[model samples]
Target: MHETRTIADLALEVRSKNAGPFWVTMELFMRDAVGYTIVADPAYLNASTVARLYGIDADTVQIFRLPALHVVKISFPRPVSQGSLRDRDIHAGQHHVPLALFPLPSP
Candidate 1:
């Protein structure tokens, strides 16, 4: 296994929100470019890895890296529509717990 650190160790804030009725997005904001670079690597933060964390198909996930802002954003299809009677998360905010638990490679 790779040497790793929690996102909490590098990100200034980690948040999740609803993109729409069908999607949830997670945002990881790092304090600076050095921290951002460490977590921004595709090897550690990508669709397939995130899909595994959320127990979803890789095709349903998308990742964006914003070097200028030192942030990483990820969007994925939700199994249920937002605010649907069957939905477990309404704001889509709490879904970021899984992302927080994912380990980033150590620099």
Candidate 2:
């Protein structure tokens, strides 16, 4: 069986912030090149995968891999407007906690 490691173990940082009133962005910073390659692959960080992870529509998910920076940036439409009465995250920074728990195949 393949060994697995949570993103918290593989990434140096996992965070989220508001892109705008309508969007929230999540970022993953890898500690090394191996971790970067694992998460940066299209098979892992694409729209479908992120959509499944965030429980959002696939069409709303977008991801960018910054190899030079060892970062994976993901963005999607926000369910509620930023700072709206129903919004739980005013800065959208708390939204990435679940992603930190995502299980990845360990290297």
How many backbone collisions does model 2 have?
A: 0
Error of 1 at 66 (Å): 0.6
- Least lDDT summed over 10 consecutive residues: which range in candidate 2? 98-107
What does the lDDT read for residue 48 in candidate 2?
86
At residue 6, candidate 1 shows an lDDT of 88
lDDT of each: 0.87, 0.87
Tens-digit lDDT track of model 1 for 1-107: 75567887788999999999999999999999987887788877888888888899999898899999999999999879988899988989799887886776644
Predicted structure 2, TM vs. truth: 0.89
Off by over 4 Å in 2: 1-4
Query: Residue 5 deviation, candidate 1, in Å?
Result: 3.1
**True lDDT of residue 38, candidate 1:** 79
Candidate 2 structure quality by residue, lDDT tens digits, 64-105? 889999999989999899888999888998899878888885
